[model samples]
Target: MPDITTSAVAPTRLRIPRQRGQAPGTSPSGPILREHIDAMIDLHPGGLTWRRTFPGTLDHIPHARHFTRYLLADSDHRHDAELIAGELSANAVRHTASGRPHGTFIVEINRTTTTITIAVYDCGWGGVPRFGRLFGIDAEYGRGLTIVAALADQVGYEGAEEVGHRVWARMVQPSG
Candidate 1:
């Protein structure tokens, strides 16, 4: 594949028209309001942390995956992070308004000495994923979180799509 970075980055912009009264950024419950933000800033932790915003479309998932792969290239959880990144990014593309025109999602990676946390923040246009192990072998979709939970040391959803839905997973190396 051509260098994804150097490749003409035009097709990622959506040409689809927006619907009337339906804003591009919103939670399914309503317009994202304050009081839902679980805002916390890292105080320059000892390792690496990175964040980026990408157009919420299928084409951009690989970019996020690639970035995650590059960032965790040295970690024992590199493969787990990459898979979690791909699954989370694809879920954002498929289940949220982030996939629409003018919609976007943010990818965040926080790596410490023994763990890497991967998160995808999407414009919440759908129901928050629930924990019921909600899947079946015959189903064609909806196993993102299940896979994430299985692979990660911890997993969670924070903030509404109104404030942006944050789905995160962390993978850690076992102590010696």
Candidate 2:
């Protein structure tokens, strides 16, 4: 396992290219992005879990699912993490329509010898609940963050000024 530390500043934001048609299975752009994410996940102290971000569109869900499967198959499956990916994909589908310019979503995996951290960022208006009290236990509207919080060892949010926001979670890795 590797020791992990956060930089004083976040890593430089990379610009993800948006294609007009569906994403290519072997295109340079998509594979390049996937490699970057894989590298990040692999650097985790335990092992590379998975990290990815795609345009906030309905079409990206399949890509996300594929990536998640690829990552989980290499390790003990962490189904809780999948919930965050699903929520992010669902939000992207609900918010970003065809006429809208491409929106962005980012997923990062940070690892320490004993813990794994997952973070998701999106370029949408920041309106998701940061606190758990905002919704009822049975409320169907907004529970994604709540679920993330429940499943994670820790959970929080980071504001991106006027650009957007990020939701992050840290969870303990299952010991083999």
Candidate 3:
């Protein structure tokens, strides 16, 4: 996977485009969904991107899910997106340094006419994510990525342990 930690724009602040009649700092969907977003870059002229930073904690997993749900509400894959966000965010908090006090993780969603991608960025303490060998239904852990892969057309990650990691899952939209 490409290392995004070295990107020049990694430190830039994310900006949500306003609707024609919308006020500054407000979401078109509803009242301003306040978050500590730090960076976001458009994938392309035709794609849409939104991202937010959350303090890494198990309690914040629902916030990440809600973010995905709000963004993909109009799409057919909203449920999958929400699940993916929750799983990835949980992993970041449970496996990475982002779980430490004062640590943070980022949730980003990129959408195009044919695809939707959800990603979780962590502070890079844990090793890369992987799908462990199949576990029986009674296994207590180790199935998040497997579930994500089952729902996504593609699943992978970027960056390194020292810098950070962005675990992402992308789903292709169904034909009309």
Candidate 4:
């Protein structure tokens, strides 16, 4: 993971274009919705780490998903990582400040020999994520966290909504 120990010199920020007349964060939040998309990618130290700031627009969710897939192309957990990335991006765009006009979200994909970690950092103005599952067909959408937890060997979140919050998932795979 990239270092962000201080706010003065934190993660790199980049601008993403948005369409006019769109109500910014009011777009319906879901998967596979592609609006105009733009983002920035930052390569970190280990060379195995990649961080990007993407516009919180709904269309960018697919961009995030594809970004994770591209990063993990040679890994065994590529598919799982892609799904988790999409879900996390959706949450960031729908529930956090990332969804607002000009708002952005951070996506970091770090891989080691035996484990891969995907972390999504959202603008800290919305509700933080938690593990919640509604057991019903018509219970809206509440299985994202649960799905993430079930797929990743380790899943967790930290930080505050004031500055930002990060939701992460870690997968461990054996080298056959």
Largest lDDT belongs to which candidate? 3
Residue 21's lDDT in candidate 3: 83
What do the candidate models score in CA lDDT, each in turn? 0.74, 0.58, 0.83, 0.78
**lDDT (Cα, tens digit) per residue for candidate 4, span 5-81:** 53342232222334577677654433321111111111333436789999989999999998998776645688999
Error of 2 at 135 (Å): 2.8
Model 2 C-alpha lDDT versus the unseen true structure: 0.58
**TM-score per candidate, in order?**
0.70, 0.59, 0.74, 0.71
The TM-score-based order of candidates, best leading, equals: 3, 4, 1, 2
User: Tens digit of lDDT per residue, candidate 1, span 1-176?
Assistant: 77533343221122233567867864335332211211122234555679999988899999999889876654557788999999988888788888889888899998665667899998987668654477778997777778888898788888875766898997775432
TM-score: the better of candidates 2 and 4: 4
RMSD each, Å: 16.3, 11.6, 11.7, 15.1
**Best model number under TM-score:** 3
Ranking of all candidate structures by their lDDT, best first: 3, 4, 1, 2
Relative to the true structure, candidate 3 reaches a TM of 0.74
What's the CA error at residue 15 for candidate 3, in Å?
24
Report the lDDT tens digits of candidate 2 across residue range 8-121. 533323334455784654343422333444466567556654567677776776676555544443333346656655665565445433114666676666554456666666
Model 3's lDDT to the true fold?
0.83
Off by over 4 Å in 1: 1-43
Query: How many clashes does the backbone of model 1 have?
Result: 2
